[model samples]
Target chain A: MEGETIVKERRILVAVDESEESMYALSWCLNDLLSLHTNTNTTVLLLYVKPPPPAYSSLDATEYIFAGDAIASMEKYSRDLAHSVMSRAEEVYRDFHPRVKVEKKVGSGDAKEVICVAVEKLGADILVMGSHDYGFFKRALLGSVSDYCTKHVKCPLVVVKRPKNV
Target chain B: MEGETIVKERRILVAVDESEESMYALSWCLNDLLSLHTNTNTTVLLLYVKPPPPAYSSLDATEYIFAGDAIASMEKYSRDLAHSVMSRAEEVYRDFHPRVKVEKKVGSGDAKEVICVAVEKLGADILVMGSHDYGFFKRALLGSVSDYCTKHVKCPLVVVKRPKNV
Candidate 1:
């Protein structure tokens, strides 16, 4: 082993959301991939992206006055959701890979852009995501995050699709 | 641990080709993913697809008579190419994952269909592929195999994009 360069650590970013599919992905990554991998230096990065604050175009004085309050409440709601999602992900990690280090990340912007940027900025070795399996029409309308990341993310990307029975 | 149910084995199907990208994928899967993973129960299935024999429709007696010989020679060339590709892949596996169990499979058809069918038939827990990174125009015209498999394959799909500096 002398003179041999050993990879001390690897960062794996897992994108989570409120959807059941995302949770399943986190569980699968932990139970099947992380737990099975012998690399003790692996760190799991759990990322949750909140949509950007809504823009209010209303010019009415009354509507403009309340816009700040409305935006504040929406931001608070987003923060709460992110926390809850991270907690759920942490629970799965604790159950499956209790010893592995886990980092929580919350980004606000388009999910696709935020995820791609995070992978690059965090220097993730691998990026794991859950596929929504939105059918043709819906996928076209909604734009799939995994699909975008597959094309844009610089690192290796894994898209886990939950089985129907599960 | 006596009564704990342990998964005896997992199948990881890796699609290979003559392209450097696919070879890079195989190496990455072995060195970065398989070598680090503690699971000794993993089995790698290497699948290679050769394009279907060319169709010859010649009404002339002389042309028809020569067509058989031409087709035979082409078939032989295809077989030889497949063998060469397999040998190259085996070499990589030997260097990186000598002890890991690897099964070689050669199928003749469209790569997309063959890969998807093989994944389902083999009950692969994960499918690893290399992205060609064909830009928009090229991808639109040639159709990316990884993109197709990502949408169709039942198991989790990992698309490894070789780092540009590498």
Candidate 2:
């Protein structure tokens, strides 16, 4: 390392979900991108965004118990899904680069906003995401997370699109 | 090298210009991003887009000679600029990573369209660009090459923004 340039540690944030696309992005970042930076210290941050809980309106006396149970169950499901996504992401890079540092964060809000804020908060050097490849009409109506982040994130962004036939 | 993944060659198209912002991006890609991919075969493609020659309409006899001279000078300038830009890019990466394979390409047209078409024609696995960081008003009016490429490029894209203070 005598002649090598050693800069401060760099953080790369990978936004993940249950979709295979996100997982593929994480794997690609590790196997294809992160492996080459032999001199720089890099930490991979994994972010899982849970959709905000639905609003529960005023419930009649008879409906109160059921509503409470439903809310609790939904919360539990969200927690479980977040855990599963993190676990899968961990399995990916850990297998590829055993020594790379990993961090986990779960945000509850609109993914586009959450991801943008997370990048700023974490001071990420780069943000990596997997494109959902939503068609023109669907993307227009629902909005794409990667597309939205591109306009808003302060740091560099890499949107990985899995090949259609792969 | 045993047990390492040796995938097909990867093509990374990096759009460059005379701007320091773009040069920073090329350095970042070589120093931080491409350095980590220890096993994969990667080629760095440097693309330079020259503004299309101005449309010269029919001119009166006296104007024709001067116009021809001006056109020749402008073409020479464009050619010289392209050469210098490519030479600078090669110097940066060669100093950083001597063995990294590099290819140069020059295209004439609107930057956005030429970049998008180049990615598709080259079958680039990834497209890397430097953001101009145009203010909201300017970006809306002039349009950004990186922004347009994000919408149109078929493969993954990375937009690197150089910090203002740096």
Candidate 3:
């Protein structure tokens, strides 16, 4: 006992979005990953990344193409969306394991970039995310945020797919 | 006790290849997923999918473009590769948990289709795979096998990314 070192608590980051795919991932993390003996002291980090606000050119700004109130409402909507996602994730976590410690984080930027940066900053042992199962054309057009994070994140990454019936 | 229902053994399918990424995934599965208390009755299916052999056109057949011996040797090489990958995975499994059950399976066809079909045929509850973390250009040029499987596999799919320094 004198020479033994204490094991550090594992940090697991789950990326939450508004889609059911993401909610299923949260459930999977709670049921499959966190409920394991190996994850006894794990801490879950619920993260939501919202796309950055649209940029307007100087000419458009001067012409008042978008009203100030409209821009304010759009910003508020994004914030509300992020908050709602985190709240739903919290409910799922509480339902699965109420005693587990969880932290909620929100960032506005490219989802891929925000996820990668948060994983590093949080020193996460593993990052969990849900895949939307986008087809070839859609994936090519929209670009896969999880795919990008898989390449950029330094920690082990788990991309969970939602079951069809779910 | 007389009325107790039997618990079904969980099947976990892991897609293995000749790359370090796949090997890392095998290691992670053994250490993290299989070592958990909830996985006591789990059986792991190690699958290796070899690309389909090149097709010979009628013109090529008439011209005798491919040497018979060369074609035979190439097929043998692919078989050998699949065998070696399974052997390596077995080593990893034994290193982590010697008592766990593991089965090796080999298929020839498009990697994506083979993996999806194997998961269904095996009735796997979960499919585990490794991501090579290919860049955007390479991924677009040569479609990712794991990406395709993630979208197509009916079971819960876990795509693991190896830690950068590891």
Candidate 4:
């Protein structure tokens, strides 16, 4: 960063699960991007992915988490979800930044598809995501979404580590 | 993974060089690990990071690239610079790993420290490497031996997307 100046204008598309995991990923991006920006025209999109609920045949006991209303009027729900996450994240961002313009959005579909769509649709310069550290058994049994995203996305993607517990 | 049973008995480490923009980090890991197995106990470590080069303000750019004997004690001369990267990675690892372990390391120093420490001292599962992708502004940067291996370690790491055709 010696003689380099920060470029603050790129659109940043981030996947937010509203989970601790997402907070970790978002913080890293916010912090790193903040360090590099010259306030070029940056907008942060916090995209939340809600995987469709599993059917009765599905082995997951947690299917209920995404049931009924979770999938109903997904577009409307996603909009609200995005708004909620961004509203909350905005408060945190203000604490560190005063001039940054941030926005949020919600989408429905497979995590990978949602992300891919967001990048193309939003013209994002970067995608920030968090990886859930799964146990050997769990990972072997179920494939990793984060790993898949790391493999598929075209833009500069970062699967950031969890932030330290301050 | 349909009917296929997952059996990761050994551990391998792959490092990804962080300094350079990386495009084919994982493919590189797969190529190397697919070939070797340490008694069926092998798992690949797709590493991609190394520490920064030690201050050689006294040494010229030529001296730094050709760091003579100080690098001999390490692995291949091609990957000599990676030796000092661990200083920047802020690595945090668990104490015990059960089966074939796939780990990612990031180092801020030179490339060798991350690879050597993970392979020779830390007992990495294997190593994989690849050159970074080149954009119009950045030319072939990750291909430097020291930079590529810095992202990988010993064992059987694979390499992919070594070419910049992309």
Q: What local distance difference test score does each model get?
A: 0.88, 0.85, 0.80, 0.53
lDDT of 2 by residue, A1-166 (tens): 8997776798999999999989988988886677555666888999999999988688897787888898899999999999999888877876655567888899999999999999999999899998787778998899878767777887889988777777
Please report how far candidate 3 places residue B91 from its true position, in Å.
2.0
Candidate 3 vs candidate 4: which has greater TM-score? Answer: 3
lDDT of 4 by residue, A54-146 (tens): 454553647655564555666566667667766666655675664666776767678777887787788876677665555768966776655
* lDDT of candidate 1 over B89-143, digit per residue (tens): 9888996565688999999999999999999999899999998888899999989
Candidate 3 lDDT for residue A155: 72
**Retained native contacts per candidate, as fractions?**
0.66, 0.70, 0.45, 0.00
Residues B121-140, model 2: lDDT tens digits = 99898899887776789988
For all predictions in the order shown, the interface RMSD in Å is: 1.5, 2.7, 2.9, 15.4
**Candidate 3: regions farther than 4 A off:** A1-7, A56-67, A135-140, B1-8, B57-66, B134-141
Scored against the true structure, residue A123 in model 3 reaches a CA lDDT of: 87
Q: For model 3 chain A, where is the 10-residue window of minimal lDDT?
A: A32-41
Positional deviation of residue B162's Cα in model 4 after best superposition, in angstroms: 10
TM-score, prediction 4: 0.47
lDDT of 4: 0.53
Cα-based TM-score, every candidate: 0.92, 0.81, 0.85, 0.47
For candidate 2, list the clashing residue pairs, or say none. A35-B36, A36-B35, A36-B36, A36-B37, A37-B35, A37-B36
Residues A1-166 of candidate 1 have per-residue lDDT tens digits of 9998776788999999998889998888887777557655889999999999998885698887788788899999999999899888877788555567888899999999999999999999999999888889999998878878888998999999999999
What is the fnat value (0 to 1) for candidate 3?
0.45
Two-chain DockQ for each candidate model:
0.65, 0.49, 0.43, 0.03
